[model samples]
Target: MRFVPLVLAALLLIAGQTAAARPPSAVFLNVVAHQDDDLLFLTPDLSQTLKASVTVYVTSGEGSHPESMTPEDYAEMRQAGERNAYATMAGVANRWDRVALRTGTGTTAELATLRARPSVKLVFLRLHDWSDLHGLWNGEVASGGTVLPTGSPARVEDTYTRDKLTKTLTWLMDHFRPTVIRTQNPAPLSGFYAPDPDNPDHTAVARFTNLAAESYEGKAQVRNYRGYDDAQLPTGLDPALRAERTKAFRAYADVDTNVATLFDDTASYLGWRQTMLNRWPSGVSWTDGADEAYAVLGDEVKRWRRNVFGEWGKPVGLGGSGFAPAVTVARQADGRLRLFSLNRNTFDVVTAVQDRFGDYSGWTSLGNPNGPGGDQTGLPAAGTDAQGRLWFFVRNGGGGVSARQQNADGTFGDWQDMHGWGVQDGLSVVSAGGRLQVFATQCSARLYVTATCSIARLVQGESGFEWDTSVVPGAAATAPTAVAGTDGKAHVYFRATGTAAVLMAVDGVVTDLGNPGGPGEVAATATGEVYARNAAHGISARGASGWRAVGGHTEASPAVVGRGVVSIGVDGRLTQLVH
Candidate 1:
């Protein structure tokens, strides 16, 4: 591995600061399975966060049985290659000093320090890298299956009970105190990795990292990046960034030295380019782009929901400072209510739940169901079904539909592709007549003056969910909202193209309700009352007393909770009128 004594001596002689202590600008720690994993899955952002960053490799990339190289040679070469790769990323010389790091269990592992930039470091745990065997080990750790023994396999000496690993990780956190932590995807889709598909080692590392972080409860924010699934998804980076990534991987795969290596020319490393998808922390912005607007009413009030108590619990040093159209609300069967909103800081789907006693939980993220939803303009639709399953849908960045449902245990199922294409507008979902119906608007070029926008429907039937699209003609300019009325029929509402009049669709018939006042946000209640927000942001209902304004100015569209309606104020407080 070409260890030079001169560099080690110089690095040791000139050190007043430990790698753990640095200026509090930003410190990022990335925990990955193998050597090249961070480059393959966490990149451009990983490279961007280079200042004061530490990467921890759980496995030394030495397989259980090496066919062409000795285990020592393989481990050393992989470590050197990783040094070279990070050096290339930092645009500096490839010289690092090796040191010993004692874990919580009192055993030592190798830690490398970049000579040019002391802020960047690499810690190797030297664990076995067998795919099938380590996968089994990882699965056991993930499911709390078994406590792994220490000092097995003979080559690398450290033993790792899941608790020991977690403690060591917690020790690292307490030492470094990073501001941000990134790890691989701990959870993947069911059946997506059934037949020996994804790497189990990657999932295991991510889970262990999460456990450690939870135990430590440090100030650092955690983000989970997708691993092997990148190969199947579209490339997320542009050409320039992709070219730089190619260079980094080339360095990681270089193996012309005397030492045997895990990376060689035969591997398809050149073609390994794809977008890095991550579950951005609840309130942190992944990008600097201005927040996109949505035609749906609920999409605008997310900021109020996220920062209702100010910045006490905002994600990753971020706070909801302004208004955005990204809130949706659904009522649970037992008088509880769920408020869904896009994080003002991240623009990702985040939600808060209220119990029957009116106590609200902290806002939790469901992540971006679609990988950045095409153009970072993801429009979310949320509702509760007949069985109280909270369903979430998003118009993806590729202009396609994706969905997921909350399980009975309160966990969410993996996002499922609903296969609706060319859907660029906002979406609305309703559970009616024991069926879940999704409504969206699609535009098509016509033989007339301009393109025509029409409403499309996908409803669940005896044979499963089927598309009965373009059932009613509508404007493509704005989004649509739908709700199942107490009459056991579906009611859809939207603004007609180029008009302020609110249109209603029921039983495949479209009727105009006339313009009540200004732009109106509409919703149907449990009492069969169709309500809309008026010009002054007040709630008005089409009730037995005729269409009349009932409340004062509301910050956004009000949500139906049980038999009444509730709204949030600009000062981040909820006002419920139980009529």
Candidate 2:
């Protein structure tokens, strides 16, 4: 690690103490080329993780699309616009304090600290635009943000090199040590090396940010969002969310723009020119068109470290193989972790096993449920029965739930159909009350459908698993998460389709717990406490006092181990939380 100067360290420590009495569960650093990149392309995600975030603009918002205003006025207006938009999402007044920070190379940057959430910050580097840096290739490899004098207002201070830019970003990482990093997508190399479909600044800034992350030795979960083309695609937000987004964008445009903006004009500008794109990097797949990434939990073969409380083992490994982005893990009574994943390219079901000592036996393929050339979709779920046998549930190629079990002797059983349709992956099975309960989300209008994709429940008795095909209230969308709480009642949690509120259904009664804004999984300790990952990617548990934001950032659905909850983090590592 790079050494921190005594003065700088003291300042950082003081700032940390004053920012929040308790450290933020996780910090997110968002680096972009100009203003509004995050607001434009990274929605719900940016809003979801704004609790402790920093948005860094590499170039001043000036120099692009010149109008009657002076360069300085345009720049200040853009910054003010961002402040208004961010303040709306953050639920605070538009107030911030400015601080001056210097990179290791002595290059200065402007840091704006939120008045309400001091931990949340904004940094501006004021680099040149894409046009000035275009065609200045160093041996067919073009680089931006490395040098000055090509354009930008900051040119008088110094010219940068790729190495210097990397070093500067490294300085930011050293100071913030973000748990998550968001940047624009870097266009991948193609056979013909086609021109980038996004803004050159977006691509360049992303490349520099990625390289800086690579040079930094510390761990940080990173994701890339689509750039300019995002606005041209379908609006990722629902009507309600789209309206909320319009208000935010309107606030941005009204901030010092002084132009009378009609509601229709603002809405049009947002929908037609600044909407969020639903695509992400392949490893980080989007969920139902939303931007949060997911991984299979409890996959076998990854190493798991014990939690800080030594209550459960931490997960280790990069999760399951293949291009599929989702995975689900189940903990067996024997203290083993069974991971189930889908092969997006091939639709094969993959399984891996992890032993008590944290050793993985590698991944094993179970072949496709529909035989060769089968097309499968959605995520798979796993559970264990009272007999200690593992059960894997998947949305079979035929659009119905299928199941197979591991015999007591550890042998595999033939796949069996769990008939009743309306299945689209996102399966959750739990052994409760001496019976195995299977839950899934069903399309309302399709085969075995309802009005919308509603929650469906099936119970396995001595006669075998049977579906009620009845819709669970408040579970009008996505998958259902079931856990037997400490109260001795089985609870099912689901996001009410349109509202995104997490509704807890127990014994036919459902309570709205507000929107978690992300997919959730259920885990329960032996003591009966229920836990799930909150919208901020932190662990939260339902106790007598209600839901509390526990710490940790995870990308996988949670599984229970003893009294602790464990899930995969964005770094493809395991994170555990125990009371």
Candidate 3:
């Protein structure tokens, strides 16, 4: 392994700091397909956190360059561009110290730390771009293949099969221990709005990153960003922020001849620079009961009790395994709290019930009606009817809603397919009177590309559930969260498609709650107070007195527990703030 003298000193200093000070409170990891992907699609957010960020370039980013520029040379050039861009973002000199790293999997990778800001690092796996990733994804690539970038000091030889790539990513996660892992969209828009679709390499990298995250032991929150298709979405950044982002990209453009024109003619790259959208914005699950709050930390369910002073006690873990990070809590007629979650490995709906003494039973699989594959099922949502019967709902494999209700004997009935198509995840089920109301975002096409998307409501009728296809006005971007208000009306909350503005619909009337939006489902309390994640990842609550900032950097939506709000912190711990 080779490292410059300065880099060696920096590494020793970093090691010393690691031994002395506490680990970073927040470490943001950006895993992208190409060198410039983060600058183009994930910037502003990327630049904003330069002090606590590490970006990984999965591919060499050598896309059809001129014959004069060899593939290795092109990869080096791109890496240089990225280094320069990140240096600019860090407000430091354009000098980076390169060090060779051997990942836990025994594969040699390159790590470049900004000379002035060691925390702003860049990792290059230097895998072949496009076809190689696609081949790995399809299992056509053989093991033992080797890729060596131009300036790589060691002979890093690895075939980069799907499993190997995923393992490598997991190894990186273990090394960095990021609080947030951001990647390109695993399921990118195609057909209508995206004629070209996202680069297959982007999708492949994202899928591998997510798989790695799932296999990783740490509690890192995974976020997916839109790739080229983000151009079709409305501009997410304001003018001032856009200007700042452009400066960083321009620094990169200066080093890369391929995108040099972007430096002078900024209009061509404006769409991508001005907009940054998350493929899955919703956060982890937190459910509020009468006196306690339940949150899913990693795969296990944890409960927090409220004391008489309205303060929440430290959480007690409710043991479960192989479950998704999101959970739904429903109250049983006998006052037990039942939790529902999707099985991460099998996509099956799993349930666990809390006993009278607050001890949780072992998780019981509810068997997915959407078949066995993990992708076929979404997170489960649970609610209790006026009759006090518990019902569980999930987005089935067919993009429709499937439900199961508690039987009179306490066991759940067979899964019933509530026929509606193209529904997204993050289903919200609220019970008012004797009926259950299910609100979700049903799109005509893929969410990022869809021109026709709305909040669809499925209301339980005397015969069965009937669908109100367009219950909310305007285009909805996220799955709707509905709560039955004290006025006995179902109040629906969703983020508007183009504006990202939080909107509430009640009795056919729509109210625009100002955009404090980042990405995630809008949450509402039982008493009608609304909460949504703001741009800074903090909670914003709108109550009778209007909107107020609820300070907490959370990984998911805030849960309203009685007079307090509960959120999962960036470190994957549950935090409750009493009003």
**Candidate with best lDDT:** 3
What is the per-residue lDDT of model 3 for residues 1-579, given as tens digits with 9 covering 90 to 100?
111233343222121111112448888889998998999888767777776788998878876555888887777788888888887888888777787776766666678888789888888887877788867876777643545666655345665667778888887777777878888876654432444567788878877787788766666667677777555444544455567778999888888878885554323365577566666444323565446766555446667887898666887877766555567777888887787776655668888887778787688888888676645577788888777788888887677888998998789988898989867667888887568898887766543442466788889888888999766776776667888888888888887765677888987789988777565677777677778777666888876676777888765678776656778777766676546
Candidate 3: regions farther than 4 A off: 1-22, 39-45, 63-68, 144-146, 152-164, 184-200, 214-217, 224-285, 296-299, 320-322, 446-450, 543-546
Positional deviation of 270 in candidate 3, in angstroms? 6.7
- Best candidate, TM-score: 3
Can you tell me which runs of candidate 1 are displaced by over 4 Å? 1-6, 9-23, 64-66, 131-156, 190-195, 256-268, 279-579
Residue 66 CA error for candidate 1 (Å)?
Answer: 5.5
RMSD of 2: 10.5
TM-scores of all predicted structures: 0.54, 0.54, 0.84
What are the candidates' C-alpha RMSDs?
14.8, 10.5, 4.6
Worst 10 residues of 1 by lDDT: 284-293
- Give a tens-digit lDDT track for model 2, residues 1-579: 111111221222112111223335567788888777777666556776677888888776566534676666566666667777788888887777655555666776766677887777888776665543222222233444422211222333445666666677767776776767778755421111124446677766766776677655445655566664432333323455556566666667666353225334422244333334322212111111111113432221234444355543443455443324455666666766566666543667877665677456667778766886565434567777766777877776556788888876665699888876646446766677766788876653221111345668877777777886653654354457776566655577765654555577777787776543444344544355666656565767777767776677664446655555555555555555653
Compared with the true structure, model 1 gives a TM-score of 0.54
Report the lDDT tens digits of candidate 1 across residue range 427-462. 777788888888876554222113355678878777
Q: Give the lDDT ranking, best first.
A: 3, 2, 1
